[model samples]
Target: MSGGLVALLDDIATLAKVTASSIDDVAANAVKASSKAVGVVIDDTAVTPQYVSGLSPSRELPIIGKIARGSLINKLFIILPIALLLTWLAPHFLPFLLVVGGAYLCFEGGEKVLEKLGWLPGHHEDHEEAGATSAEELEKSIVSSATRTDLILSAEIMLVSMAGLSNEHGVMRVAVLIGVAFFMTFFVYGLVALLVKADDVGLRLARGALEPEDNRPGPVDNIGRTIVRVMPHVFSVIGVVGTVAMLWVGGHLVIANLAEVGVPVFHHVLEAAEHAVSGAGGFVTWLVETLLSGVFGVILGAVIAWLVVGASALVRRVRARA
Candidate 1:
């Protein structure tokens, strides 16, 4: 009886070790996969803040919260399952889907450029100027728009993550995907919440720091005043950065995808640029690649914008007659 009990105990210890090893593998895989999606993660962060801009001080945090919630749902409930199915059943379709996503990024980046150049018009600036809108109405519009945008970005992120992972068992794939989804939503939206509340935080600090004399400034008040002064510049910088990111990332995606499908032109051009710099070529190489990518992104974006606008007008005309 004692001999039998010893053998059973030894078996249980081996099982425990196996389980621990499996958990470690899952964690390592999750991290690896998540890192691949970093570009889309950056894009997500860049794009989200714009949705909350131009809202009143009190509505800012609440609007961010709503969008954050929607983003979470998009990743977990919607994107994760679809990603798993795509990976499992239609792995071959992944690259094509990524190209479609790349085209979308290019189109969006192009539209922004046109709007900036006064060739196209978007309602975003006008909406910001139309003040005193009800919080509920604003919240609904912002959340809906944010969620729709999130879906595309989330799809890109998921595809990147999927491409990074090994063709593992179904269980492991699902686990890694779920892990990536949760991590991205938490990281992106947490930063957004902080960004949207920054001005309000500054205001509160300024108001609380009452001067001992009516004419004197308190430390908190001074700090708040500084923040208020800087807020406009900060937001302007964010907007500029977001637009640049869209162009760079979208261009990079298209170039990379083209290279993946055996297009040698972009790769060879980048290689030539790298070689031209000789010993200190790394910086030059990076600059060349970025500039080329931005150019491609802008061109692609413009073509897409033209098509979409023409299509929309045609549709409207057809509907009016019908």
Candidate 2:
């Protein structure tokens, strides 16, 4: 009886050790997977703040919170199930879906470029144009647009994460994917929340400095004013970076998917460029590839934009005639 009890205790210890190892493995894999999607995550973070632009300072965090919740829902409920289904039933379709999403990113990024160049109509609908009769309506519109955009970005992040964990098993894979999703949403939105409120924080500090010891501007007051002044430029830089990232990632997707589908010429060209630039430096090779990808993305995006715009015009004409 004593020996049997000792054996049972040993077995329990063994099981506990195995469980602990499994949890550690899951965490390591999730971090690895999440790192693979860093570029998309950066794009997600940069793009989100634009949605809250021109909104009341008080509403910024709330709007960000709502979008983060929607992003969570998109990853866990919509993207996860669809990704698993496709992985199981029609794995080939995953690349196609990725390409489609890439094209969308390209279209959006390219349209912004054209708008800046005065070649395309502006897409941004500011608060006045919204004709929002109530705060709720305006918030709803902003949240809806943000959520829609978040869905695509979140899908890309999840798909990228899954691709890295292709070798992982059933329950482990799901757990890691969920971990990545939650971690990314929280990180991105949390950073965005801080960014959007930075100006407000600065303003408060500036006021506080003035309220205290001396009514005259001090070093602290100067620092606070500097922050408030710097935020707009910071946001503009973020916007530009986000647009460029979208273009690069979109084009990289196209090139990669094309290679997977057996057209390898572009990949070969990039490889050759890497080889040629090896004598120079790794950074040069990366820069060459990135520039090439951005160019491809811009061209693809322009073509798609033309088709979509033409189609819309045709539909408008048809409705007018009817």
Candidate 3:
């Protein structure tokens, strides 16, 4: 009986070790997979703040929290199941899915570009145009809009990450995919919370530096003042970066997946650029690819945008005539 107990104890220890190792591997894979979707994540972070742009300061963080919660629920409940189903039942069709998602990113990014250029009228309904009649309704609209946007970006994040995990063991793939989803939600929203509240934080710090008798500024005071002034520029920079990232990632996805689906024209150009920049090292090659992808994304996106706008105008004209 004693020997049998000892053997069981030894077996338990071995199982424990195996479990620990598997958990570590899952974590490592999750990080790697999450990294694959960094561009989309950046786009998400950049785009999210716009939803709360004109809202009351006190309400911003809560609205962001609601959106974050919605994002997580959508990912865990809806996206995960559909993604798993597709991965299991129709793995071969994922490239087309990527192309669709990619084109969406392009359309969104390109629309913003055209609006900024004043070439397209603003179709996106802002706070006033949304027809929110009260505080509660307005809050709901903001949350709804932000969450809706997050759904697409979140889907891109999961699907793009999944592309890297296709060959992983089924169990491990599920674990890593789930892990990436959770990590990304928290990470992106956390950064957003910090960004939206940064000015408030700066104000608090500036207030603390109010020495009635001695108005001499301390280092913290200077830092606080600087933060207050810098955040606007930061937001502007983030917006531009996010737009470019969407274009580059979208273009890269479309062109890369096109190769997988037998249309390699764009990929061939990208590869040639990489080859040309080979001697300059990995960073240079990546830069060339990104710039080229951004240009391609913008062009493709503009064409799609024109078609969409023309169609909408035609529909409106037909309705008016009727």
Show where candidate 1 strays beyond 4 Å. Answer: 1-32, 35-39, 53-59, 125-141, 166-170, 262-264, 275-283, 320-322
Candidates by lDDT, descending order: 3, 2, 1
Give the Å error, residue 87, model 1.
Answer: 2.5
lDDT of 2 at 182: 89
lDDT of 3 by residue, 1-322 (tens): 9999999999999999999999999999999999877778888888788888888899999988999999998788889889889867988899999888888888878988998999889765586545788999988888888888788889999888888886796788999988998899999999999999998889888879876678877778888899999999998888888888889988988998999999999999999999998999999999999999999999988888888999999999999999
Best by TM-score: 3
Worst 10 residues of 3 by lDDT: 122-131
Better of 1 and 2 by lDDT: 2
Candidate 1 structure quality by residue, lDDT tens digits, 43-162: 677678777767677777777777778877887888888877786698766666666777777787789789889998784523332442776765777778788888888887777777
Local accuracy of candidate 2 as per-residue lDDT tens digits, 253-275: 77777787677888788788778
Q: Which stretches of candidate 3 lie over 4 Å from their true place?
A: 128-131, 214-218
The TM-score that candidate 1 achieves is 0.80
- Worst lDDT run of 10 residues, candidate 1, spans 123-132
Per candidate, the number of residue pairs that clash is: 0, 0, 0
Q: Give the higher-TM-score candidate: 2 or 3.
A: 3
Better of 1 and 2 by TM-score: 2
